[model samples]
Target chain A: MQIVTNNPLVREKLQDHYAVDYAEGSFGELLVRVRDKAHLGYRLLSHPLSGSVKPNETPYKSVLISDGPGALDVESLTIIENSILTADKFPVKYPQMSAKMRADFQLIDYTLLQSAL
Target chain B: MKLELGYIDIQDIQFSEESKIANGVLYVNKDEIQKIVLGQEHIRSVEIDIARPGESVRITPVKDVIEPRVKVEGPGGIFPGVISKVGTVGSGKTHVLRGSAVVTTGQIVGFQEGIIDMAGPGADYTPFSKLNNLVLKMEPEEGLAQHEHEHALRMAGLKVATYLGELARNVQPDETQEFETYSIPEGMEKLKGLPRVAYVLMLQSQGLMHDTYVYGVDAKRSLPTIINPTEIMDGAILSGNCVSACDKNTTYHHLNNPVVMDLFDKHGKEINFVGVIITNENVYLADKERSSDWTAKLAEWLGLDGVIISQEGFGNPDTDLIMNCKKIESKNIPTVIITDEYAGRDGSSQSLADADALATAVVTGGNANELITLPKLDKVIGDVSYVERIAGGFNGNLKEDGSIVVELQAITGATNEMGFNRLSAR
Candidate 1:
């Protein structure tokens, strides 16, 4: 159920709203979910993950997503207890957050929930 | 107006020497019911069968599902205008057979009817599968027109349901609940702090056999107007449409509409439930524009801040839905439109035939074009020879093993617009 990104800065900024948690896979699955949502921005994050990712790049770099146990499949976006993400509006758009330490790679990336009331 | 509903929980139905309800089971005198059915002028005959939950049964080419109800102390009887006298109803006492229904089936065009699998993967999608159904395989006389045949089947089911409803009239109910709505001024005062909301129930009246009736008047010929939601509970509005099974609002759905119930559940709590506006989805462009215009005008006249609009069938009605949403929103009234999609099997096709940016707050009933496989059942209540030509069925839908592979649209109420089931695709 956990979907995460290695960029800990995104995690820190989002911690104020959602509790970013542990994830096990690469950012590919998260990209697919984004693409399925008709979110056009997932395109911006795809090329960087294919070995062309610059150092300390997009907030979605090295992201991982799985949705059955600990969290909701971002598609259904079930409001899980102890999870920070909510519904509808996608996670705050990337590049909007200011991380004092750009090189910190342990933070999970932002999660755009499916949709909320 | 206020209405007290008495629920008689029916656990099983069986043929007996006499028709009666006792100990949560309904016993029917087979000869008596068959006699009443044969009395219909257009119907040639009717064979009755029972299908309970967890049964290995399948009822195909199902035209309508009706919940038998009797007016114990209402202003008018049930099935107003069509059966009972045309007096205003939905006030006072009405008794309902809670866990039972009358499902009509026959040699209807495969595409026009729906399927109900009592127990299987298919059963999980249709709401009718869970009911204790008294299946009526009604046969119309030979050479009857399709429209005439459909009408005969529809009226016959209603007539039978009315008769069955009479059985519980004297039987004390297991439980009773009352629904009361405040008068216009009183509601405004009581719910002063809440936002005003109403439900715009769109009826299916696309011509041909596709239609809906209100007080015996075809909705397609009527103007968009307001009605007390409670009247619907008394069977003031009914499904006379021959639309796709998955989304058609059967008489059962109308009697127990999820949206109306949900709105009533929230009334006076967060939002002030005002009233219901009945509208039709006609094929003519003029009718579409006029009906939507009336809907918007009524919402404005009602001083509503928000409205929840539900559609019946797909395709042509999608245009009516968008027009209603856009016009209503143009009047500064926000709307939440509930509709199903026809996204292709691959899931990449456009959902609605028409769309507008104003339809932002949308609740979808899922994709009707999604495909699924129905495993073989132990019994088939009605013939399945027409499976291949059904709207959602392909040429090879009925396999040699008696299984079926078809679109979700082939199942009754699979993706109902009323949000009857908890089925939705992200």
Candidate 2:
């Protein structure tokens, strides 16, 4: 629902592809990797950090790295959003698709758009 | 008494008959009046004339006089009419008359200046049976000499008439068009001093002769070298001051630099035209290319109603698609194809070849200068189909450089819309 890359720099790299290769069984593991990863933190899409938790599928999802308070940082939220929309691969492996398919995928990817209008 | 004032040096010779040859006989047909007083004296009307050996002109007095003076004019001076009625010279008077005086039916009277004269009683009595005999012959023109100017004009008119007729027949309008005759009114006394103004007015008057009038002229002013009908909306008759009717290519040849429109604007009153056709060989070849490349080149080369491209050596694989593409590209410009292939299903070639062939033929065939010989067209394109319509319309000859130049009006009705549906259908 939310854009993964709200970073100011991402706009300049609009036509460039970004890879966040990960094996995530659930959304929590993906969030842990993002929180610990400084690179992902710098590029995360989120509002200022807060401790409030809303009821969801996993309310008490324990932080694996053992950080008790303020465990959810900016990076974790991006990983969370990325995990939910992982099925939608904007940049599919090139050789696997035909010219027509590539064009169709490009059409769907908003980042690939020259203009929203 | 009509006496010879003096001899007139022939300026030019013109044929009196549509055709220009005369043959016949002669005789002495003048009455001789003799008078004697006292001893012995004689006064009679005596004169000499030339005609066929056995035939002669009878004497008639325009006024009462002893003898009348006469002058003979033509290519040669007059020949002698028969004087002695008794001898082998006058054996067959009927044959001589038939040969000299009588013009057979459907024949034209052609006079030889050296063979006949109308002088004295002979001038009054001359019996030109050929001139008077309409059932057997047409009326003879005044004299029996052919002038180069007259020949050129006649030739030009005939050619233009013939071409216009063929074009009208091909277009097949609801009603036929006739070439209108254009003539400059006798001496505009007001414009006598104003040559330019007079010329302009004459042109406008000529153009106004019909709703659509086509005229051509040799580029000359006074004694025209060639001429054709000035207006072609009547019956293709020759009219106006045409100087280029039979000059062939140059008469219709277009040149670059100053455009023909400029020429027309300056002389619009004298020269009203919608478009022009350039018929010179070099000018034509300079504009030719394969069907596609040629039309544009030609439109620029010759300011024309439309450019026709003739693609030869088609019906081959390597060139088929290219020729097809060219034909399609030239959709707006009228084009022609001169080929030997029919491009039909039952033709010797396969269906794919047939299809390609049909496409090329349809796009290039109608209103073209076609030299292509088609075989089994009926089995291939079907009877009376669009292809057949195009094939039927193809009647032009191939140029030496392997292109065809045909009139745009020859192909389609005058609307911007292309004949795709008409040409593409079965």
Candidate 3:
């Protein structure tokens, strides 16, 4: 499986073990990258909106997807597209945080991805 | 299985030299309670406070709310595997501190913790406001990990609640209610002509801060299985979720689940209340598929003619809700899903992330995105600095005058998916 993440912790911990696609942007951007991959027939192995933490709240996210291209999975495309729409519904408001809080968010994101793995 | 819940109505709570329940008043010894909370090394300090109904108090970044309950004559203690030894607990009598609750709050572990206003327009939104809340403000050690921090707070809440529940052990209850569910064969024989119904409870188990425990076992690691509905009354399910406050089922909600209660209200009369099917909302697609498959199989195997599925948190779980609905409906078993919506601020966006035409019968717990202004209260029990960062709060959401403008999502139990709140649309 391939991991798409914007959190540095997720990339750092999983790069050696999996195909980690690191997105250097916001949480929504990471989902967009995963959506783009879904468009290329990479089936989503995890729900894009995995955690209940809203899209605009936490700044980090990590989603798992298939490592290679295959037949276009309509369900994957639909879920990713719907996830993007849902994420957009909540206006992005990435609040500034201390380094410790940032690390906490990163760790939470990494932990969520690990649950799927 | 049969269980009896004896409720000791608590009118108020006060700090005293000794802890006891008498004349509908709960007197607590603060030092003893502090000792229980500080027993864990991860926690550095804890402050105990009380917030009564109709008081001008606000508690924010709240973690979990647990009702104090003691298994008076049961095989096991309250909070089964977590606080007490693992055993069958739903078969006997349990005592409940009816009007009192233990509310846990502290340094925000995640951005999804919620707000509970004792009295205000916001008070009308949360059920916790109506309870005599014993608030615990706990601060963790300097740099505890997020997982450990959550575990510490969860344990503290359960521990304190259990400790307080002990006070009501020998007291006479004001009222007693009994709940029972029969085995599959017995149910079929007893309620010969009635429709068989079951409750599908979707637990929050997405990740570290978002999880639920069943008999002290993490629900995400288990498959969908059948459970005695009465077991829930004895604290079989506990919330370890840091999901958004508006919808996450707190331990209090689990103990007094409206769906279970309402189903029992009509049991044997309108339908045969079969049992509860516990499932988890995991992040992995395969797990979701497997759980939903098992759920459908169990429902068909139980000969359920109808089911009421209650979802915990939103977003990803919506997919599980729909999958369960569709798969179960595919078996010719009708389903009624209970959930809250995030239909945007204007209430124009789609209600759920995933949808299927088969999910036609639904019960909505209002819209979480609908915004409201909470007037500043006189006393704030927990820190309000985390307001702007909480799930439903945006930048500049907390005003200078202490009043906060936020979506209903910020209020605890505002849009509870369990039909626990009064918010709903026709």
Query: Which model scores highest in TM-score?
Result: 3
Q: Assign candidate 1 its CAPRI class.
A: incorrect
Candidate 1 positional error at B247, Å = 0.8
Question: Model 1, stretches more than 4 Å misplaced?
Answer: A1-117
**Segments in model 2 whose C-alpha atoms lie over 4 Å from true places:** A1-117, B1-346, B349-361, B364-426
User: CA lDDT of B118 in candidate 1?
Assistant: 93
Range of the 10 consecutive residues with the lowest summed lDDT in candidate 2 chain A: A48-57
The candidate maximizing DockQ is 3
| lDDT of each candidate versus the true structure | 0.73, 0.21, 0.91
Q: Model 1, range B18-61, lDDT digits (tens) per residue? A: 89999999998888878878887788888899999889999988
1 versus 3: better lDDT goes to: 3
Candidate 2 chain B minimal-lDDT segment of 10 residues: B201-210
Pairwise DockQ winner, candidates 1 and 3: 3
Model 1 compared with the native: what TM-score?
0.78
Candidate 3: misplaced stretches above 4 Å?
A: B108-112
